[model samples]
Target: MQTDEEIGKVAAAVPVIISRALELFLESLLKKACQVTQSRNAKTMTTSHLKQCIELEQQFDFLKDLVASVPDMQGDGEDNHVDGDKGPRRGRKPGSSGRKNGGTGSKGKDKKLSGTDSEQEDESEDTDTDGEEETPQLPPQASHPPAHFQSTPRPLSSRCRG
Candidate 1:
């Protein structure tokens, strides 16, 4: 029977071992591929090379057998028994992990536009205090209106504003 510390060490190394094993397997599978492609002056891996490595039925069979044997997030060969990681669930309240909002931009009342400012803007435009006559903008051409205007007709109230 392995000691608790030995089991813990092996469990910690499982992910690294799996990743390295996959890397080596892929490198070995691609060993002759570069030479073949280089001789042909091909820019990418050939179709035959891809087909030789990726047998879909065999891959599915292997995965099915693996899942049937293990059938969990934890893989075979060792019982890791990892604890439930205590991070916040998705969309939960932000935790007290050195994060602070500083109480800014959350209140909606601070964003309301004041009535007097809008009234003053309207008064200024109506007066046109620069002494230039407010030229009546000509009715836009039916076929060639401004680039930004849509083809929809404007309301009478919108077009005839004094």
Candidate 2:
């Protein structure tokens, strides 16, 4: 069993790992985005291009820690780590339920409202306290990922955990 502080440390480290991984991931994505944007001068890379970049980046980042975590076996030649290639770990596919919104159904789809759904009803109400027009509250952290696809994971920490 782990103490709270120890668990907290591991939890904290997860984001750092994610952050470092995301930094590289975004770098590659931006490079591709720039490449596409420059080639066509379009407003942005098409959804397919962005999606490909994201998936590849996610794989790369995932592999970085994964490869490091494997134990070395002096007697086994398989223990050697090579650059750019490794056996695939069983990963949850992108958009799997575990990664889905914390019970907020898919974005933009109309959800059925029960009469008792008072909280849900109030959420849709438009509130404008300031004189400025209410910009649609962009889905919390939605724009952080390329244009509306909600599959992006939050950054985990960088430190090592048992």
Candidate 3:
């Protein structure tokens, strides 16, 4: 039901909106990083300060990889230095299928269950039967009397009685 021009406009606007949001987020994060740097008595905001801030704050944990380390000026003859202008390479490394447990999928669930004590209890419970795993029953809820029902009733006022 959408025209090509309308669809194109939306697609173009998406990147702009995302970039603006990212810019605002980065600005605020950098301000916090500056404050952290000042607290450390450092005149210049270093990558270590930013890294420390990111690690300390749970919200900024995702930006850990984004703040790359500054290259060692001593020149130890090692190429450990990452360029500041170009950020770290994104995406998964080679031979990674973007799956946990080596792409075995749901089999990982069984592997995890095999090591758990609850799974052992489940296996023990099934031993008495035909080896079929029964659904674990949740603990019975403790019934508490309602506050209003338990409390003494208040006496009615003379005005209400009249």
Candidate 4:
């Protein structure tokens, strides 16, 4: 507790347990970080090395948010960060369908539309909307009823059968 704050009491054993847990965590973290440093052939451990250690092991997954702020030399960006050093998950390509935009991620090449598509483009351009610009009308969105709205019957247990 601070000077003016109320003191909060803790059990003596709690500090010993917390101290042991912290000691083990730091030992593992430093060992992994040191491995990363050796991999880079660097004598000193850097923040990037520590971040790599966190990203390498699933046990360290919880520390991702903290290590994400550390910068790397390569501008690999956040794309590779999601799946960690294992690369893309489920053996999918980096720019594959795992992406949100129907696999047409920013890396996807622009598709060339042809035939009736080109004609429709010209028709839209030729439209004369007097002096006002035409506003595209969007289709109404679909709404889903809450799951709790429907009730399911459950079989009675032998002890509570009526």
Find the candidate with the highest lDDT and give its number: 4
Q: lDDT score, residue 59, model 4?
A: 90
Residue pairs with backbone overlap in model 1: none
Report lDDT (Cα) of residue 57, candidate 3. 80
Going through the candidates in order, what is the number of backbone clashes in each?
0, 11, 0, 0
State every prediction's TM-score relative to the real structure. 0.25, 0.25, 0.34, 0.40
Which digits, one per residue and each the tens of the lDDT, describe model 1 over residues 1-162?
Answer: 136665644566777898999998668546554544454444445443333333333542443433343323222222223236342222313432211233221122122232456644543454332423244433212223236745789789999989
Query: Which 10 residues in a row give candidate 1 its minimum summed lDDT?
Result: 103-112
Which regions of candidate 3 fall more than 4 Å away from where they truly are?
1-10, 65-162
C-alpha lDDT of all candidate models, in order: 0.41, 0.44, 0.53, 0.57
Give the Å shift of residue 152 in candidate 2: 68
- What pairs collide in candidate 4? none
The positional error of residue 63 in candidate 1, measured at the CA in angstroms, is: 13
Q: Any residue pairs clashing in model 3, and if so which?
A: none
- Model 4 misplaced regions, further than 4 Å: 1-9, 75-162
Candidate whose TM-score is highest: 4
User: Across residues 1-162, which tens digit of lDDT does each residue of candidate 3 receive?
Assistant: 136664634566777898999999899888888877667545456566677678778888787677646332223232222345443234444554334333332222343335568765654543242323234443212222225546556667843775
lDDT of 2 by residue, 1-162 (tens): 146564534555777798898899778767975664454433334443344344446544544443444332223223222335453233444554222334342343244422336644554542312323233333433223345556656555633444
Candidate 4, residues 1-162, lDDT tens digits: the string is: 224457667667887898999999999999988887776655446678788889998899999999788886344342223223543233334433333323232223222332356644643453333433234433212112224555575666744866
Off by over 4 Å in 2: 1-12, 51-162
